[model samples]
Target: MNKEISIQLSNVSKTFRTSSKSFSTLRDRLINFYKKNEVKTIKALKEINLEIHAGETIGVIGRNGSGKSTLTKIMSGTFIPDRGGQVIKNGTSLLLNLGVGFSHELTARENIYVNGSTLGLRISEIDELFYEILEFSELEDFKDTKIKYFSSGMIQRLSFSIAIFAKADIIFLDEVFAVGDNKFRKKATEALKQNWLKNRTSIIVSHSTGVIKEHCDRTILLHKGELIFFGETEKALAMYEELE
Candidate 1:
């Protein structure tokens, strides 16, 4: 049977240009005002091609500065690839990384409405699920609290709750397990197994080999800003361990 392609990337790449000159003080800034700072290019992702099937759980693993986050951002439409690169998505996608996409100055309740609306939920729908989102996040006490005051765990839980309840078609989990406590991590893991994996396309980026081995059917191994391997979970883990 042929599976539907949820995401397709063709010649996708990202590069960042940075200036070498730094101005530490007003005098330094004035001195460099007319001078052109030498610009350097860093290729965060080399031209990479991939096709992810709908309802598949893909894992991305790599050491620091290995372009893992960059790749996910591109896939989730947070970052645009250079010219001649292409990314095609079959459905609405959401990137769940480190409590991003939330306004910290707003109350948790307000952010929930905003986020839920972004996920295509009507205001009435968000109103209905508002309490459930708070309850699931174990953040009932902080519903009215400003998000800036919430702990990382609290923010992560709230973010995850909103994504799950919002039913995003493609979810990119970027090191999300790194923030929450053990108890909440367990709950989140279980929720992923029960809810997200059943019918959605998911890309999980984690440092834990156990997580990739347990949850991913296939994994992509990235090294030094390049995708070196994309295949069986065990094989990718073996290559990652060798790099480590």
Candidate 2:
């Protein structure tokens, strides 16, 4: 493993198993009890091979069920790849997805502490950045309010604020630009470009072609759980459009 590579995936794959049975009535249930349930396997990702260097900003683009989110989760350590595959992470990583790693029952202020800790921040570090997070989120007045009471945009703002300050070496963002109103989204995007993405390894999953062209150094395209392309941003975008 190269020390400069922040993330590496080799022959990675993911599959989920589910079972279903039909029993409309008690008699049917009794009759079906002796039969095996129908099982199905969903292959979310297959044979993924990638190597991301430190401080690189990469974009991931795909249509629905194309395995973009699954690949992000695998890179973020939230989902384990299937057997015969390997994932190597060289530094701290954080995944910023809608409503992930947050406690809705907790107040926004409390969630900062909790989410910061989960991102590997110490109490003192979070304390020092607490006001900054509040300001960035533009929710200073709602700090004490429970997250459950916040709108989806508010929660996303808070999450992105905390993620930018978490200081992780690798960051994965899933549809982050879709969050918040225009002004706040612009603020968040600038923060990422100027501060976070400039120095960290970032994998951004978004549907916006403009975002990928603007911020990403490289792009990866996925289709039907397979890696379709990984190269220059413009080329990948072209390939993605062709798939559509």
Candidate 3:
């Protein structure tokens, strides 16, 4: 039997508008007020079509500025595609990237409550999972410390631990293995292999071909804001290697 379609994107594209004008002072700002702002439109993603199947682990590889992150955001509903685009998602999704869903002003303890609540857990449930989250993140000592003081690896570890316990149906992991120390990376990889990704649909966005090759059955290669290749993991990696 065919696998269920977990996500489908048709004619999906994203464009960003940026201003080129720079104001160095109040007078500079005022001088440019009457002039039309020089706006540049950059296509972050072109018309892309893709179908991701349920329970499949997919890898996305690309060079910088290749729209890998944009594609994941669109799938996770964090970014809306341009007009005439459609996104069909079949499950509750969570997007995991470095410090994306965290509040720098809040302590780790406070963030647990906030993030857990956002994930549909009640106060009591959060209380129950609170210790577990901290333990898994190996951040029990810094629970009351403010997030801004934490290192990037600490933040990513905390973010990932929460997602695992919350049991999100679809997970978009963006460069998860990049920031942390080797020990944590090994631990996280083991957890994914042993428990986390079982029967779950996940999209891993990473520059590491080894991670992609080991985890993903299929992979997609993006270049210059376009979906250039999608097929077997080895084939996609080969194409990405040539591009690099």
Instruction: Give me candidate 1's TM-score against the actual structure.
Output: 0.92
Error of model 2, residue 239, in angstroms: 0.9
lDDT of each: 0.89, 0.90, 0.87
Stretches > 4 Å off in candidate 1: 20-34
Worst 10 residues of 3 by lDDT: 190-199
Q: Candidate 1: minimum summed lDDT over ten consecutive residues — where?
A: 19-28
RMSD of 1: 2.4
Residues 1-244 of candidate 2: C-alpha lDDT, one tens digit per residue: 2339889999999998776646556777788998776778999998999999988899999999999999999998989999999999998888888677899999999999999998889999999999999999999999999999998888988998998877688889899888789988888888888777887889999999998998899999999999999999999999999988
- Model 3 bad stretches (over 4 Å): 22-34
From the highest lDDT down, the ranking of the candidates is 2, 1, 3
Reference-based TM-score of each model: 0.92, 0.92, 0.91
C-alpha root-mean-square deviation, candidate 2: 3.0
Residue-by-residue lDDT tens digits, candidate 3, 1-244? 2489999999999999887656546786797888766778999999999999998899999999999999999999989999999999998988878677789999999998998888767899888888988998999999999999999889988987777766577888898867468888787778766554667898999999999998998899999999999889999999999986
